[model samples]
Target: MDDEILIVDDEHETACHVREGWKVLIVDDEPEVHRITKMTLAQFIFDARPIEFLHAYTGDEAIAIMANESDIALILLDVVMETDNAGLNVVKHVRDVLQNPHVRIVLRTGQPGQAPEDDVVANYDINDYKDKTELTSQKLRTLIRASLRSYRDIRTLEHHRRGLEKVIAASKGIFEKQALKQFAEGTLEQLSALLALEESSLYTLRHNAYELRNSTLETLLSNTVLLVGDDKANPSDVVLEAMRQRQNLYRDNELVIFCNNPRHSLIFHIEGTRPLSQMDTYLLNLFTENIIIALENIRLNELLADNQREIIYRIGEIVETRSKESGLHVKRVALYCELFAKLLGLSDEKAELLKRASPLHDIGKIGIPDAVLHKPGKLDADEWEIMKTHAQIGYDMLSGSDIELFQVASQIALNHHEKWDGSGYPQGLRERNIPLEGRITALVDVFDALGSDRCYKRAWPLDKILTLIREEKGRHFDPDLVDLMLANLEHFLAIRDTYRDEFQGE
Candidate 1:
């Protein structure tokens, strides 16, 4: 018989022992019967594992052992121990009370007439009923071997069932992940659960092809380690060689899986002491195939979102350029809005939304006539009134779109000009009545407009802009926001300097 099972890869091999031992519990009142059973099976080995014997002298003792020990694969239960139906009661407890249907139970009775084979087989959940006198050494060994095989098969099926459920749950989790790092971490978590290992592993991505070529195997592994927790182990020589050759490596205590994509490659290193069965290998392969698909989908979604954001920035630039303002005006304002939103305790998602939507704050100016938009001087009262209508026009153009980005853009376009004191805009909305998105954009827009040179006005000095912002706090901007901007004045100045206009040279 093969002492080890090897999961093979092309030109590379990884092997694991089947497992250690089969735990067999012997329940009986007679010391002689326990002695005889142990002697009979002294040299017995099944499935490449020796037998470990657990003895219980009474039915209660057997129940206690069964309750405490989960790995007992077979029970040689004796009928009429301490009670007439003591062994039968132990079977009932194992099957019904403990709900442990996995352990195989065989009833051995010296008093065959008391518990007949036909009655015992029909009534009790015992695997086999044998008269103690007929159970010789060889017959007992044969019976134990058969019972162990059954136990092994049942445990394998149970493992696969649990593994499938984990795969299903993991698929849902991976699908919900939006970022690459989140997806990779989630994959590591789920893979650990699938293999019944502790969450002490690492995941890595290798992007540079040249690095893979120039670096030694150990150096490559060390450089690409992205997520590592408490449980860390060095990759074995077999594992490193498998990775170098781009193949899966599975050993008794560790597994390394590789996923290749056109843009990059991912490696997952998992460690545990349990040997994986053939079925485990199959299930792991299936789970990894699904994970690769999910990872690719998340990558594609990220690319799509980047494209959409770029298109929005370009559209905002066109509107700004039409009004004779530099496209950099919107870029600076967007960064300012993002920083302000974050300092105000907005979540990462909301801050990103604000960054993407702030550029469209002046999108309404696209609808204004060129004469008013490019006036080169302060707008006359009548012309200013017409230009103000652009806010409502931009809102109408963006509203009613199903896209979430456009919906937020619409709110910023309409309400960014509204005042905290209800004195400004097409809507004259007062303090808190205005959406928070509009409020943030409003402050950032004014800050950028004051510091930037535009068609109508020269850029103000930093000190003059700060004084005006402080003076108009409650009248033009949210009091809290004005305080926050002043507190983090350097951050806004940094953004202004980074995306400065062509005339604002380094």
Candidate 2:
């Protein structure tokens, strides 16, 4: 980056040969000073570009103009404007109070007696001090070029610092959606301040036409984006228009929002009063695109969570159908698993996953023959052996899935039938070797199975089932899980009784 050119010589002809290539602010009390400065630089265009001149007759007026326009690359301040030290005051205000460090300040005094070069240099933050009498045409152009070079350097450093902060904020927000709104607001605020724009940019987030949100208010602390005013116009609608038009209105311009949707868009104006620059447009487009990607990621995460729950519910139904029990059997098993997991002090996430996976404990029955699955009489050794394969079948059915619920479901299917005493099925795995989810589901499955009447069996009394589970502790079930279930026996029974399907018979 190069510095913005500024010519501070009070002499008009001395500033000639400088043209269109840079943004300059010429501050002189005399009107002739302004005219001579413009005429001399008129024929000499810098890089074939036109010059932008800001004129101020007094230091106070210059300060006010600079307040509104911080993009002034260079200031051609005259030491004597309204007061003997008027130019010096402007420099103090720019550097000390307003802190416009990016704008290069050059102190040019017509009468050196008013402000000495030594005092100005030591006491003030002016980048350069020059006496109007000493400045030649060559020196004037050289001063402008040097000042612009410095200005460009400072602006680049400032931009890099702000960009790093934005990336950090954005990364934090990516993992925590709650933090995203604030991050977005901070990014917008930094960009606005850096660019020295007039209007504070606004952000609106919309989902389909039903919900319109503003990023500032809703996103930071609430669920949606915070809108500035209520105009009843859909934000998403505006975004669609901008997208359809393929214009920079949504991409690079200020006063125009780059909208990804009607409900969500960033509304901001360019830093200066000037129209948006090509660079400004390009940067804003990049910003909007990044935000859109973040929003999409949030939406996708929510969808995946919902899908996980739905899959669990479907698997529960499949398990219940095979056992000749009402479908509610699956629901009861899930509730019991949740309660037991909580009793065991598992985290909410783990508990929920267990609840969803618990019902698939017998999912291997999906592979069992109806003769064995709905047998009216006790199975012979051959039939019994075939029945046990249901556990392995359940494990096989659910294995190799990337989804969390299915992964746990696979473990439960493989281990749920294994007895605590190492006397049960395919692997004969015992004790803590059984997955916690499998242990938790095993007890709940039995409780529901025993409490409910199957095609070939009658429903046992709650008291009887409770006694049976207590007696089998450490023999058929993991004792710790059994204790947890026992403590919540009534809660389990209530769920069992509630989900019992209405059985119709001939």
Candidate 3:
């Protein structure tokens, strides 16, 4: 079965990029200073990008603009404004208060005495200090270029820092997911985040593990490998070549990453606007290493769950065999419990738990004396009392285990015989007092048991069995469960037909 990519967002999100142009904020009280600075950089285009100018007359205004805009690349500030030390204070706001270490601040003052150049430079975190007299067009352009270049380098470092953080966080998150598909989808999503991807990029999984049908991801998180770039170029040949070679392949706008293990072979097809840079490659590799390990962990969990299911059924069969009942009884009961649980609107997780635990409802019968257990006739009052002790015995045997499966089994074991009206059971837990797991198991077990041949009695006709169940509603059985069972009788019958017991007589 293909898994749906419900945890995955269909939209492709790109990494952060530089805005329209490098932002240059001019913080000076003199209107002429702003004009001259703008004129000085009117023909300026650094690294083939233009400057976007922002002006603030007062230190307060500079702080306000800085507070609103986190991506202002450079600030050309004046030392004195509303307050004599306003520009210095703006530097404080940008550094200590805003904690914005990336934006480059160059202090330019008309009266350097208000805040001396050497003193201000040493005490404050300004990149450069320029007196008003040093206003040559060439010098100013060179200054602007130097500041913007520094800003770009810092932004790159910040981007990488954020990227690494995402990888670390994503690794932790994927490990916590027990389901294979969820983990895979999460991996694909994280992969998409590593590059500036196109909206056309698709994520799919190999080995049919994840099937992302532009809609659902089958395996590998989805059977979808994200193919990025111009949609016209088919990377099928490249993908096949990588698979054969068992090596990672990178083309102009495509990436074929091959990961092979003894259990499975997965090829990740990633596409982007341009060829992957060394940094992008490094991040993806790191992400892949974490994902492969998480995949192994999920596989182990799956194997363990399979083994547990086998052990439970085998144990239940052993107990049933002692009472001369067919093993199919446990299977039917498990399926019925799952069905009933689902119909009751229990989640998939809860429904699955009930199914796995219901088989052991009669596990306590293992401790019962064989003479009463396998008897060909009904037991007398004393013998019946001895037979009834199996419920508590089963609960006691399973309750001590720390495992969740057994914990639930203990509940089912203890309360499966409890009647709705407190008329039956070891503890006579009445009505809703019985755990829902116990109640669901009780209804389904009796329903299957009555329809099947027991050692002491022949299988009753369907009509008789259902009549007894309907009559006992609100008494022996939960009225609501009984109603649901009757309503979905055909589905129940289908389940019975699917797991047929050969001992069921004509």
Candidate 4:
């Protein structure tokens, strides 16, 4: 398996990542067995590296070792140590309890009568079984090599699966325009890691090659990075030359990759001391191809998200306006939700999603009659009941959409009204049953709502608002979140101040 590495391109680092010795665990009770096994394999090497040895004397000890050691390639086990079927139980623990199916287990027994070879092989998921007497030096060596090869292949596939999963998780949010620069930076770091290369950069310039109509290209042309030596730069020359020749460049210690979409072209210049191998070249080609596609997707998705955001604000404003509220209330609420998410340590993608989706939290309020919504006095019991239905109404309007934003928005609209305690309306879900996004919106929305002017109630003073929040901890608000709000109260207040309603000063 290629060790999880960034696409870096230096010989020394590449060698270092893959050169570590394979780990082997020796499990037996006898001191001589451990001594002889180590001596036998003292000079043995595979794939240009020696073996790392670990010893465990009992089934309990082996199980302990297996618990802590994830990368052990092989276990040479003795069947009748401590108990008659101790090795069998160790195998069960390794395979069943630990759920580690990758390590190769070889069962060696001193007494053939204690564990019949056929029975041991059939019952246990062991790769090999042999009577201790039958293992000559050559035979033992052969078994070790075969087992190690199988372990290597299995681990390689497992590592690749994990690598792909991690890539997907990280890149799933890459289409967000704000993430384009971040994605490029990560790719450069990963590329450096994958090839063991050093620090590098990716720059994108768009142009119609034949005409060179864009005026900005002139300044960009001068300061472009050079691949080798004195660091003058060539984001322009390399791209233009490669475009002119219509091929990627392959010179000694330098590589110029040229890729283009119909609208524009992308070129990269990298300097490496090691010459490119066919595998290295292939990986680079695949990476660049995917990166070009990602850059294009970000462009398209950014446009779509911007439009969605505008519609959301407009929708939120229409609802608020009918209730005699400022449109900037929605804006303030959005910013507050984002700030709360940030303080909670939500990922940038999740926090950004929350910011975008939060404006629609009250979209269901659009369905409420204006008389109840805009009433200048406290709501009657019947009117309060009617007002409470907006949560479910908003959810109904937004739920069942395949779009990710709408799905998140739907949950927020539905659950934000549900309080930290069971006293909340609609479904009466209490505590953590409420989704985190809902909890976040509920807190920030209340913070904004209490601090802002409403036709029914004047905006409360800062001290009064905080007093209520502090009193509501574990009642109306999540205790931890309330604590977080208190801890970063200044920043939250700053966000509110920044996006405060225009009428607030009056």
TM-score per candidate, chains pooled: 0.84, 0.50, 0.81, 0.54
lDDT (tens digit, per residue) of candidate 2 on 1-506: 01122343343333434443456888998887677666545544443344577889899999999889867888988988788888888888898899777788888777787787888899988888987765655576777767877876777666656655554454445435423344345444544533432223323322221123444432422333334333354444344454345333633333343434433444432223444544445555555565566656655654666676677667667767767666777888888888887877887778877887776787888888998887888999999999999989988888988877788889989998888898888899889887777777778888888877665567788789878998999998999878777777777778776778554552
Candidates 2 and 3 compared: the better one by lDDT is 3
Off by over 4 Å in 4: 1-178, 193-251, 256-269, 276-287, 453-458, 504-506
Error (Å) of candidate 3 at residue 305 is 0.7
Global CA lDDT computed for model 1: 0.79
Least well predicted 10-residue stretch by lDDT in candidate 4: 4-13
The TM-score between candidate 3 and the true structure equals 0.81
Candidate 4 residue lDDT tens string, 1-506: 11211122222112323356779999999877787777767656776667899999999999999999988999999999999989999999999999999999999888889999888888899999977777666667778889998997886676555445444543444433346446545544444444432112223222111212222454546543332223433344555666567557655545666655543344555655665544445556655666667767765667778899999999999888887777888898888888888887888888889999999999999899888887878999999999999999999999989988999999999999888887887788899998998888888888888888765567889999899999999998899999998998898888777876645432
Error of 4 at 101 (Å): 30
CA RMSD for every model?
A: 7.2, 12.3, 10.6, 14.2
- Residue 258 C-alpha lDDT in model 2: 44
> Which 10-residue window of candidate 1 scores lowest in summed lDDT?
1-10
Residue range 137-204, candidate 1, lDDT tens digits: 65677788899999989987887787788789988898887766667777777777676522222333
Candidate 3 residue-wise lDDT, 324-363, digit = tens: 7789899999999999988999987788888999999999
> Top model by TM-score, which number?
1
Candidate 4's displacement at residue 259, Å, is 6.3
In model 4, how large is the Cα lDDT of residue 489? 89
Which scores higher on TM-score, 2 or 3? 3
